[model samples]
Target: MNASSDGSTTLFVLLGRIADRTLDDATRREAVLVEATLRDSIRAKALDVPDIAQAARAARERGVTVHLLDDGGLGPYETAVADEIRGAIVGHLRCATSGSITVRILPAGRPTLAAVVVQSGDHTERYEFPAPTGEQAHTLFHGLRRGVGRSHS
Candidate 1:
């Protein structure tokens, strides 16, 4: 996906085939919580705010449901961006199956995030990406997608 005109916004485009079915009830509920938390965090940001509201609206328009998790206390802005990226990734995974994607932003040594995708029949895949800053978070977002694509191919 191309970066936004100002270059601060990273457009997450899902190139994979979207599934025909909707997310399960529990998963759908979780997605709502994540979106709400993300929206709150974005509003609390002091600077470098991304257009999360716009992206979320577009995702809803496309019927994309997203779910996410974050460890408390990691920089709000970074965590918000990571959460946003994770939500998009989860939405992409939903297109393939009733699978679930859980994104965790760890409060470890450095800003690190992990995405665990669990497919139907119990198959699972995990990806780790660095999210030290907004730009790095964007790179991590794309890297995860590219890595997943390569694995499936």
Candidate 2:
């Protein structure tokens, strides 16, 4: 569905959920095709092309915090997008959760970026990203290191 142009900033959140019996294989494939067609149509009619870095910078300037989880092995464009996202995030979390799913970020020693562990019920998966620079690490881990302040008695 298209977003309403009501002066508010639009955030397009896309979550690719695992296919299930309810959706079936064919239905899932058709859904993907339909989304691609819509995206192509929008791109064709758009006056200005979207830039990831510029968008991320705009969001940051508006005091909006961003968080990113890169699953690695991205194409050139996707890698650029990930870099922009990384630049926008104010802080990173060691762990984040959504319902039954939990994402845990772990240090991958030298060279490699941190590894991410995704746990859902009995299933678990892991992925790694390129190592962050010292400054980037500080920016990313600030929230992870900062615990909730003590309550006043």
CA lDDT of every candidate: 0.42, 0.32
Off-target runs (Cα >4 Å) in candidate 1 are: 1-67, 72-96, 108-111, 131-153
The deviation in Å at residue 131 for candidate 2 is 3.6
Off by over 4 Å in 2: 1-109, 132-153
lDDT of 2 by residue, 7-105 (tens): 122212222333323556755554554453344234322211233223323433343332223333222323443343333221222232321211122
Candidate 1: clashing residue pairs, number: 1
Q: How many angstroms is residue 43 displaced in model 1 relative to the true structure, after the best TM-score fit?
A: 16
TM-score of every prediction relative to native: 0.37, 0.22
